[model samples]
Target: MKAKPSLRPEDAGDRPPFGRSWGVLYVGVLLNLALLVVLFSLFSKAFR
Candidate 1:
């Protein structure tokens, strides 16, 4: 029978060189804001 290989933490890629969570959050916020603006504009134009 063949044996399964064991996994180790060291085998994983190293952590990102710099923190990345904040960048993702910032991008999400910007996208949300943009979507809100577009929605509002469309609604306003429709009402007009």
Candidate 2:
């Protein structure tokens, strides 16, 4: 079997697939959760 090439952080090939920072993705997830929580609270209040 052939050996696979190792990826290094300093190498140009080692980059985010979305071409964006991981922090941006994490922030998006957090904002989405916040929006969902707010919507659910509104929905629960409407039913009560």
Top candidate by TM-score:
2
Tell me the tens digit of each residue's lDDT in model 1 across 10-47.
Answer: 54554334456557767878999999999999999999
Off by over 4 Å in 2: 1-5, 8-15
TM agreement with the true structure for every prediction: 0.56, 0.62
Q: Which runs of model 1 end up more than 4 angstroms from their true locations?
A: 1-20
Error of 2 at 37 (Å): 0.5
Across 1-48, the per-residue lDDT of candidate 2 in tens digits comes to 999797676665544577377678888889999999999999999999
- Which window of ten consecutive residues has the lowest lDDT sum in model 1? 10-19
Best by lDDT: 2
lDDT, candidate 1, equals 0.76
What's the residue-level lDDT of 46 in candidate 1? 100
Alpha carbon RMSD to native, model 1: 6.8
- Model 2, position 19, has a per-residue lDDT of 34
Query: Candidate 2 — which pairs collide?
Result: none
